[model samples]
Target: MTRSEVRTVLLDAVRELRPEFAGLRLTGNEHLGAELGLDSVARVELLVVLEEEFGIEDEVDPRIFMTPATVNALVDQIVVAEGVCR
Candidate 1:
C-alpha cells in the first residue's frame, strides 16, 4: 500500500460512485464538491464506500466534505485513517 495505490483506490471508488469520473484524469487538485459537482448526499455515499473499502473504523472529519476538498486530501485522510502506508 503506497500513496499512489491509495489514490488509485480513491479514484476507483469515485468512478464507481459517479461514472463521469471514470474517464477523467485526476491531478489530485480536483475539489470533491465544487470541482467535482458532488452534492451532500453523494459526498456521504462516497464516505461510506471509502470507509468500507479502506476499513476505516475511525470517524472521518466532517470538513472533508466541504468545497475545498481535493483528491489528494482524501487520499491522505484514508491513508492516515487506515495507516496502510506499508
Candidate 2:
C-alpha cells in the first residue's frame, strides 16, 4: 500500500483504540507515545489492532510495531511489511 493509504489505516486503528483522537489531525510527525499519549498498554493494543487490520500478524513481528515512534515512521514500517507480507 502507498504511504498515504497506510496512514489512513493507521489513523483508523489509532482512532479505534482512542476515540478521543478521532477528530485530531496526524501530521505524521507526532510521537505515538508522547504526543498521542499511548502508553505501553495502549501501544500493545494498537499493535494488535494494526496486525488485525493489516492481516500480517504472522508475517510481521508485533514487537516491531510496538516501539515508540512517529505515526509516519510506523506508516513506513507498515508499508514495508505489507509489501513483503504474506
TM-score, candidate number 2: 0.72
How does each model score on lDDT? Answer: 0.69, 0.70
Residue-level lDDT tens digits of model 2 in 6-32: 677767777777788888876867888
lDDT of 1 by residue, 1-86 (tens): 57897677767767777788788887877887777767778777766766676686445565564433877887777567646556
User: Model 2 Cα RMSD, Å?
Assistant: 2.7
Model 1 deviation from the true structure expressed as Cα RMSD, one decimal place: 3.0
The estimated TM-scores of all candidates read 0.64, 0.72
TM-score of 1: 0.64
Clashing pairs in 1: none
In candidate 2, list every pair of residues with a backbone clash. none
